[model samples]
Target: MRASPPPSSSLGSSCQSSQCQTEGNCMTDLGSIRILYMEDDPGLARLVQKRLKRAGYFVDIAEDGEQGVEQYQAGDYGVLIVDQNMPIYSGLQVLEILSQTGELPPTIMLTGTGSEETAVEAMKLGASDYVVKDAAGGFLDLLPPVIERILKQYRIVEERQRAEEALRESEARFRAVAQTAVDAIISMDSRGRMIFWNHGAGDIFGYDETDVLGRPFTMLLDATCHEKNDPPMSFFEVHGEARMDRGIESLGLRRDGTSVPIELSISNWETISGVFYTVIVRDISERKESEAKLARMAHTDALTGTFNRHYLVGLLEREFQRAKRYNHPIGFLMIDVNRFKQINDQYGHTIGDDVLVAISHELVETLRESDIVVRYGGDEFLIILPETNGETEIARDRLVAAMAASGRFVGLVDFPVTLSIGCAHWDPQDPRTIDRILNDADEEMYKAKRANHEQEGSRAQAPPTFA
Candidate 1:
């Protein structure tokens, strides 16, 4: 057989590298394109090694079918290209053994004689593809892309499995946080049945988590509790839209059939299985009472239990954003107590503070519920009116008339208290940041003060109002 002349070893890219066998094959980096070549001919094995390596594959050569099977048992090779005739065991016998295990790598059978019967026999023995020795070039060309594609698919499958494992770990972390949370974390099915309730839920609701699981969330509500008639749906029905941030309140019934206030934030989501809702509930009994105290503290001037300057600035920011988004107009009115320092110097700081508080009460009683009145500074206050028009002068006139009718300034001991008005409408397109808007309002307040001084020939309280 003249050793087949080793198939031209020096053919450059057409053949594998000279040092490839001893140098370790370069194709190992191609990710799953490892190949096992089995033949009794040493020269043929070397030739095959060179060719396959050049084609970007990791190749290991064995002289016998026995050695080939041994190499396959080791990890990380993907395709086996076998010579039909080999020492000790024939290629057919190797294929039979591999088939029995049902874990065989895909194989390309090689026959030296190019007999159709031999090729057919190889196929029956589980050969994935086959080639004759003289015409092996064609096989080599088709071989790589086929094996490459198979390896690519295998890699994708492995990656997906890895990703799934990572998702499982992430979900476990979330569950741990939910279990340890101080506020109750509850999840419900699309039908409003409670599916998940944390330990906090049981502690706060006075029900065992097990007893509540699978029950309708409405079961927690007391039938005799005073109900809100604003919406036709029961609180549970309203809660379905809660996750959409429709509103932040939800009413919860206690285990003892008593109504307890709850502040709820909800979220809607879907998983591989189906749709679900998650609700975070905080018992607001303590919070409401605390808020009431804070409201009284906030509404009262701090010096006199009336609204503070902080309230004015906060309301302006809120109203500005709201008016900008909805294209509604907002009005701002700034009020300053006139020449009260003389009264303070004579009547003392206690009376000065009382004068500030008394003025705030008059402002509060003078404005509508929809209006927000805030103390701007020492002896100064601001009011905000929502849903005003492009021109808020009529609204300004109403506030001025109300202040005059309240007779707040008539009983002043030293100087008469008066308000100077400057009003501007919010432009939706050029709506300013809260600081900028307040600065503009403050500037207008100064202008109004100057105007009042110019008109009355004396310093008078000026409440500048903007829309």
Candidate 2:
């Protein structure tokens, strides 16, 4: 219930010095700041209410401690004034109840003359100050100043709390953003020790945060990969260096000691502790593999999987130039399968394709890695060998034996197929241009084919054979 209203003793919007009985005791404006007063005595509660209301503060009076606690919780009050003695709950009990909810507002205890000890106990329960009651009402004037001082202190505390809460939210947002990145995000301390590691780091480097944190940042790097180049991590090891950059390719070491190609970026920032670095690493292994595949496709024969004519021209040109400069001999062997058209016509195109694949595989296995086999055209191939001077006859003979040694379906055919090869060997001093030499080899291949056909002699042409 509301406390009794005061008798008709009032002041202006603010208390004048003469009205307060003490010099320079004027009330400042209390804008929208409410007050809660708990005083069981009817006369005193009304007196305090009227005086504060006239001094421009909206005041709500609770006649008992229980009612005071309820009104304190229900209202947005700036200050609480509770008397020590009450009907149900004492001033200390009210303060204790409010403290359980959260930090209480600026509260002052009204104590009787010898109850200074109890006031101190109330302060421990979160009361800001205590006022001693007197028979003459001399303590009434002290209320305004005590309330003002406590509210000032309360404002300062609230601002600091707001700033701290804002900082915590900002950090939470940053951690969220770091965790969502697809690439690995790492944070290092001034000593280059990892302090923060995101989930992406775990996925890429095959390591957990527990396994990574407190480890040196350099542990993830392959030192051997950067020996010829300057190390990127060195700038932060010292106090000052402009080592921050957006990107660079580096080899990242995994937990299994395998190397992974990664595009990495690191930047340094200053904090109170010293310098820190943020490193972002992306695994580019798939991208590198794709680029290599594209390069191969651009220069490879799709059906036979041998080097195409385009690659052959480039290789021939480069090799010819090198042979001229180094004064070495380069050899070209042109080979064709005899009766290939008859095989495709007799055995269908599917078996023809398989035969072509098989032939290319055999040629690849027989040739040295340095020798390139080109699918010059259908049923024909060109072999380019560098620094293999005067080895054309030997190389051709080796190939013929490899093809003829094995038992193959060629024996079942009416006419067995064979490979006819033409060899051209040239020295740097030879007058023939590389193109002319290639043309001569092509001509020689037809001559060799006719010679083989004459030896095989008269029969319906057999199905084509790669033997």
Candidate 3:
């Protein structure tokens, strides 16, 4: 090997040190740029190395092209400076061989003064730049600035490639999420015309992408509601500001011309093209149906499907206050099925429940819609008549006549099916408590029951049974 250049200069540092030799399998350390120079002239190599080292570079020298390639493979370098005329191989030959290993570093080719043709040929062989050399060594001044410019260009290219790669990955992730999501994800332009429809939107709306890509977004809403909404109401876009929603309920018109309940959330983004909106929609029909069923179960009697005692308590309090305020006439009918226990004991509880259900239905059908019927207790019902207008007994008589005409229990095992009906009128001006008024109706009912028993003692027949 040629003697090592003086410590004052090197074209590339001898990486006898383990760290530099193995770095990324030859990737240079950018923090400290190290360079390799190949030249047959020892004096010229030494001068070049010293000048570059003074310019803040670590430099090492190889005597010829063959040695230059060998030293390059053995060390990490940020730059390469090679002489065109070498003792064993030409600088172009060295460049051609080094290209096979991997990408070469920012490189400068050294040529004799006035040999611009040789310098251009070196550039074609992958040299980043070329330096004109003379006996006086005027080329050193150009070397540093040329190296800095080439390095800057390399960094710009790498940054551009990374940015393009990141953008492609982001687009791929968006396509995957949009294609697989279960909720309808729809995109609309600032004017609210549909632009992108994904798999979820097609499945929900019963339309192909081609069928609705250019349609108005409001086509998915009920006609009556869509008119009120238009496009401006669907999203909040004020100036450059955009707003997002947690959820808003709406009616969605399906392709089959039916309406479905849906919930929507929206997001907005802006691009050079203009503003855009994305809407996510979820179907809520099942939730609405469940809520309605639960509400009914909470307020109605489970066995007979009539308003239960709990509902009646609230209803009575409101009605009581209203009557006391306006001095209106309110009537109560305390109705009890005669011998209901004897019917259940003879016919079984199954029939007893059926009888109660039938009675509840009959009471509802007989009364005005404004009237209230409550299953007050086993075998007992309370009917409320608002603004009775002195027709309390008349209303009770009409119910009895209707039940007889319907023959509700006439053939049920020959049992004498009858009702003990008692009426109590609320005198709004009186300071009596509701409990006392209800007690009066109860006492009147017992009196009616006793009278019915005395009147029918000779005629009442067998206990009721299913017909």
Candidate 4:
């Protein structure tokens, strides 16, 4: 007599050979699904293979667990169906081997009757699903559905893993950019509490992540900042409406309690978690110092350190306007160094420059702080005395007296430095432009020069005194 078929679960009385063939043929029409089958029993293995092939599956049969592992490594099968009781190695061993090779495929295990313990052990070893073999051989009907479900689940797991890996890479790139930026980059929550601070922030603010995290953003700003009236949260709420691409200049407070000028740009974004604010801060101390230096260079005379003509013109025009509006008197003194050309010819240009500088120092010393002194070009100076009504002569006399007291010029020593000064007063009622008034002073200065020459001619026989 023929050997009885191995005990296995039945698909039901209706699922006989004819019905199995129909179901297999119907599944086969869908696609060429590949499966690796491992069973020690040749009869059972052949039966399952024939049924699976009929149901649109390309099935590879392995008579033992070792052959199963070899076939699994050699072929790219979508699913592996292994019988638990096998030669060389058990089905669980085969699953473990496949897992070690790489990510194992969706797997289903076939267990003999009364071998439920072995099926459970196979699952622990990475089997996706398992079915028990019965006398009716019905487990073959359940095979196709279990493989289909496991394959669908496997695709979902793969897609999820890929998505998670991409997210990690994206976050790493963003962190790298933020940490390497030159300007301090900071992020805070809607409550104005610090959440993230990059390396640039630590470098600029002198505060490490530990010192700043969860702290109020106002701690890093001066008390006199524009947001002083609002609390930290309120300030963030107000500024979080839009992006500030252009940035505003303000003072930033350092951890050492000193203040630094900073250019700040802010931007905000929102997510389901909450709103976030980002600030980019740049220290502008060097830039401000450079600008101040440039302004001083523009307004000052290089040689004598007095106001240059360009700056003098602007100051005079402003003073003129103020005098006219207030109906006040403004005095302009045109001063020329007598025999300056003779001094340069006899003593070289360096001595002439020294003489000019010395004279400028004297002028500054004699004048009040309110007076404007200018180096009006080579060998000439201009002094503006605002609100000096009838005191123009008194001011000029005082300057001459100061020069005489210094006792370092022509008559006192050998340097021959004397000033010929002519004064003009602006009367608001006169209604003349500042330029015309200045011209009047210039003419008077020339007249004074000629008068000095005549006096020198008359006094040629005697030693000279102060002009």
Largest lDDT belongs to which candidate? 4
By TM-score, the candidates rank as 2, 4, 3, 1
Misplaced by over 4 Å in model 4 are 1-157, 173-182, 187-194, 216-225, 229-250, 264-280, 320-329, 386-394, 407-413, 427-430, 459-467
TM-score of candidate 3 on Cα atoms, chains taken together? 0.61
Clashing pairs in 2: 343-464
The C-alpha stretches of model 2 lying farther than 4 A from their native spots are: 1-30, 37-56, 61-74, 81-97, 107-192, 198-200, 222-250, 262-289, 317-328, 408-414, 426-437, 450-467
Residue 403's lDDT within candidate 2 is 65
Candidate 3: regions farther than 4 A off: 1-157, 160-164, 186-198, 207-257, 264-280, 317-331, 386-388, 407-412, 425-437, 458-467
Q: TM-score, each model?
A: 0.41, 0.67, 0.61, 0.66
Residues 282-344, candidate 2: write the lDDT tens digits: 999999899999989988999899999988878888998998999999888899988788888
Candidate 3 on 186-283: residue-level lDDT in tens? Answer: 88887888888888887778888898887888888877655565464353442123224357777888888888888888787788988888888788
> For residue 368, what is the lDDT in candidate 3?
89
Candidate 2 local lDDT, residue 140: 78
Question: Global CA lDDT of candidate 4, please?
Answer: 0.77
lDDT of 4 by residue, 1-467 (tens): 11111111110112235654664532122234567899988898899988877666778898999988988778767678888788898888887787776666668888876576776676777777788888898888988777666655654555566678798898689779999998898888888899989998888889999999998888888888746656677755554543576777778899999999988888888879788888888989899999988998999999999999989868887887898899889988899988888888888788788888888999998998999899888999999999898888888888877876775455333744667888898877877787899899898888878777776778663322222
The global C-alpha lDDT for each of the candidates, from Candidate 1 onward, is: 0.67, 0.77, 0.76, 0.77
RMSDs, each prediction? Answer: 16.4, 8.7, 9.4, 9.5
Worst 10 residues of 2 by lDDT: 2-11
Best by TM-score: 2
